[model samples]
Target: MSDTRTPLSRARGLGSAKEGVHHWWMQRVTAIALIPLVVWFAISLVMLSGADYAVARAWIGSPLVMVLLTLTIVVGLYHGQLGLQVVWEDYTDGALRVFMIVFTKFIAVLFGLGAVLAIMRIGFGG
Candidate 1:
């Protein structure tokens, strides 16, 4: 008699969850990228504590600051989306899973954009 149980029989969920591992890894890598950025950002804020608004704006208006801020926003948004996805997958299932994941991402994108805009507003005043 044949053993009959194919290798595929042991797997769970739809097809290969190929993107799952990629997403997981990306999230971790992005988080690692943010650590130094956040530290630098914090130190920058502390260093700028004595400066006036114009000086503060000039500091952040520098190309270096803009680039770093952009990187931080991208990494933060991606990390937030990934972290929320895990929570969503754990807490909700079926139709709700799709809804939660998409909704969470939508909200994250909006929040991230808002944060970036706020930073830009700081750097470029009214």
Candidate 2:
């Protein structure tokens, strides 16, 4: 195949980064994974509403509940990070875009770890 890109375009290295498909698939997968987890969480909250602190803590202390809650936190953060990454990539440019993407990811991870730690501490009666 003949080279179709103009000399200027080639010189500028403007082309597909070859990551679009992977990013798209990950977004879709995370969205699907979040659906059931979020529904379960919403229902659990509704059921727990107006309950005393001990009751709520006991609920979270269940092994199954702890595992599911951890999954929810991790998956939700990852999904959120993926979304903010796309927004940054689309709306920003150059150094600002890079900074926003990295910053968003870092914040997501930090918050995710903190949340998981809190959940574990409560679930384990620490």
Candidate 3:
């Protein structure tokens, strides 16, 4: 195909970063991964709703549940961060954009770690 963009348009340097498609693909993949995990988590919550603290702790401490919960935490935060980055990119510019991106990522990582730690503590009876 021939180049259809005007000289001025080309000179503006607005073009694809080539990384966008990868980001988009990852977002979709993570979202898909979360579907079953989310459903399981919700149902588990309902099932455990009226249970005693010891019962809930035992349930969470199971190896399988701990692993699944960790997976859910990691994937959910990653997906959330990706979506937030897109929103920040779309709404901000320049220094503000950079700050927002970094801030969002930092917060995501912080929260992810906190969640994992909490899960581990519960699972390990710590």
- The lDDT-based order of candidates, best leading, equals 3, 2, 1
- TM-score head-to-head 2 vs 3, winner: 2
Q: Pick by TM-score: which candidate is best?
A: 2
**lDDT by residue (tens digit), candidate 1, 1-126:** 976555765463233563436786788799899999999878987999999977877887777898798787778788988998999899989999999999989988888888778778776665
Q: List clashing residue pairs in candidate 2.
A: none
lDDT (Cα atoms) of all candidates against the true structure: 0.81, 0.89, 0.90
TM-score to native of every candidate shown: 0.68, 0.79, 0.76
Q: For residues 1-126, could you state the per-residue lDDT of candidate 3 as single tens digits?
A: 999878876776554573436788899999999999999999998999999988988888899999998899899999999999999999999999999999999998999999889889998777
- Which residue window of length 10 is worst by lDDT in model 1? 12-21
TM-score of candidate 1 to 2 decimals: 0.68
Residue 87 miss distance in model 1 (angstroms): 0.6
> Which ten-residue region of model 3 has the weakest summed lDDT?
12-21
Supply candidate 2's per-residue lDDT for 53. 88
RMSD of each: 4.7, 5.0, 5.2
